[model samples]
Target: MKSREWTDVGTKLFLATLDGLADAELDAPSLLPGWSRRHVVAHVHHNAEALRRLVSWAETGVENRMYANPEQRAAEIEASAVLPAATLRALVTHSADRLAADFDALPAEVWSHKVITAQGRTVLAVEIPWMRAREVAVHAVDLDAGAGFADLPNDLTAALVADAVAKQNTHGNLPGLAAWLTGRTAEAPSLGRWL
Candidate 1:
């Protein structure tokens, strides 16, 4: 999808996901082990902001950490998780708006420019938005938020499935990411049995 399209869809998906949750629901654990719904929401919000900052920094011919480190990022999310429910929702709303505006203002030329990664890699600026979309799209389901992978446009889901398939990692888990991503199963199987 185009950058503009991705930004619009991301806004919709994230908001819909947030809207489905009750104040206490945000603390519920998700499909991703050890991550609560709030953690996932904060991760999505932080990632969108981080990616926007990366693109902006690239435009300025400078580089910075996309996140201070995984530990720091986790800390930020955990801290945010304790805010009054309204405050947390407001944070998400504000961050999403900022991300959309930042992306919408980016020039066409910058879309193709390289964004240096915090880990010493680079990806095109346009790719960053796509990554943001993927996070919102997939984790929406991971959190059991109202909108899910099935709610997303088929083209987008298909693309995400393809990406997941290409980057499949077993981690010694049953059924595995490959099977789940390829429509082989809706959820992972019990780890007691592995083929």
Candidate 2:
């Protein structure tokens, strides 16, 4: 599927999960360590805003950092965690809508413009949608709301696995895992507690 289509699918999965949560569930811990479901929702909202800033940078030829620093990003998420369930739900929905609009409004020519990600890698504005798609798809499961990798499109899962293996190769810490994934090894080697 195209990035936009994947983004839509991810958004639907995320929103459906959010919609089903009770107020108490919002305070419950998510699959991600140390993050409650509220934190997960807040992160998703903040991520949309961050990605929008990158798209804005591309369109205007200005440098817009996704966050001032890791501290600021963490503080924002913590601050947002106090929002009521209804408010948090609104934030998730509205931020996603605004991001989709921003992406759709970008001129075709500007899609090739470069912007820096939070990880400090320069990427084309065209890649932002896919970035958001990955965030929503993975975090939907992280929210512990019943969505899983099986619920995502096959193409998206395949793309994410390929991207993960490529990143692991670049990091040089998963040589044996990479060999196993690529069929170079007959049996998957033991890589204890990698995650």
Candidate 3:
């Protein structure tokens, strides 16, 4: 529950993911339709940068979008995909570090600030690290690194399972919490199915 602890999970997960992948493997498509491993990594990198911006804006008493906008954020991940594998890896590495630094620099109380994301959802600043951690951990599997919800520690996997369940109603036919976390489902449940 500590802010640093959450960030540490993200940092460690990302690093472990990096170790598991090869340059060519990063661009390979996984189970997510039309998305390569690169896409997943880009999403995580951009997400970190976006969180840094969000936290900074919150600290300054300025209400900025958690992401510039949905389209804009998507464009960022696509842009990162243009880089060669090595360059993309470097970008992700640095972005992760910067994100952790940003989180570490926040005043202890600032983690409690509420911010509205581009998705039109409001979440506390302290929750950002958990958000990023899930991204890295789940997508690490998308890259076919042999990591999965089952690979995560029990506590983290339990939390992710809960989140996957809570998101099921709004997001549509997604791999239910148990399916995804337990590897019973191969593809993510279709968001449109529930919608």
lDDT of 1 by residue, 1-195 (tens): 464575567568778878878988888887777788887777777877788778787577577658877887778878887778788788878887888788778787877878766556678777877777777777777777666666777778777866664444434543565576578989864443211
**Regions of model 2 farther than 4 Å from truth:** 179-195
Q: Candidate 2, overall lDDT? A: 0.89
Q: What's the residue-level lDDT of 126 in candidate 2?
A: 88
Of 1 and 2, the candidate ranking higher by TM-score: 2
Q: Which stretches of candidate 1 lie over 4 Å from their true place?
A: 1-3, 118-120, 169-195
Using lDDT as the measure, the top candidate is 2
Selected candidate, larger lDDT, 1 vs 2: 2
Cα lDDT of all candidates, in order? 0.73, 0.89, 0.73
Error of 3 at 160 (Å): 0.5
Clashes of each: 0, 0, 5
TM-score versus the correct structure, for each prediction: 0.82, 0.91, 0.82
| Local accuracy of candidate 2 as per-residue lDDT tens digits, 59-106 | 999899899999989998999989988898999899999999998888
